[model samples]
Target: MADPTPAEVQSYIEAGLPCQSLSVEGDGRHFFATIVSAEFEGLTRIKRHQRVYAALGERMREQIHALSMKTLTPAEHGATQ
Candidate 1:
C-alpha cells in the first residue's frame, strides 16, 4: 500500500474524530499532528493519544509508519493563542 499523504491522513482523522482544529505534516512515512478537540477534555496524555490512534484505526497498523501528535482540548488550544 502507498503511504498516505498528510492531507489524506488529516482527512481520515477529521472524518473519524471531531476536531476543533487539526493539522498534520508528514514525510510520507512519519507524521506529526496537532489536534484540538472537545473530546480530549479531562483525558490523560496517553488517553488523548489513544483517541487519536483510534481515529486513525486500521491505518495506524497498515499504512502510517509513525504518528506523533499533540492532543489538546479547545480550551487548551485557546490558551496557546
Candidate 2:
C-alpha cells in the first residue's frame, strides 16, 4: 500500500478527534502533528498521546507508522502561542 499523505493523516485525526487546531507534516512514513484540543485538559503526556492514537484507531497500525505529536489543551496551546 502507498503511504498516506500529511493531509490524509490530518483528516484521519480530525475524523476521530475534536481539535481546536491541528496541523500535520510528514513524508509518508513519519509524521509530526501539533494538535490542540479541550479534551487534553488535565491529561498527562502519555494519556494525551493515547487519545491521539485512539483517534487514529486502526489507521495508526495500518497506514501511519511513526507519529510525533505535540498534544495540547486549548489553554496550553494559547499559552504557547
The per-model lDDT (C-alpha) reads 0.94, 0.95
lDDT tens per residue, model 1, 2-65: 9999999999999989999999999989999999999998999999999989988999999999
Which TM-score value belongs to model 2?
A: 0.96
Candidate 1: misplaced stretches above 4 Å? none
Worst 10 residues of 1 by lDDT: 50-59
Q: How well does candidate 2 score on lDDT at residue 49?
A: 98
lDDT of 1 at 76: 92
lDDT of 2: 0.95
How far in Å is the alpha carbon of 25 misplaced in model 1?
0.3
- 11-81 in candidate 2: lDDT tens per residue? 99999999999999999989999999999989999999999999999888899989999999999888887
Cα TM-score per model: 0.97, 0.96
Q: Which candidate number has the best TM-score?
A: 1
Model 1 residue 22 CA deviation (Å) reads 0.4
Q: Residue 27 lDDT in model 1?
A: 94
Off by over 4 Å in 2: none
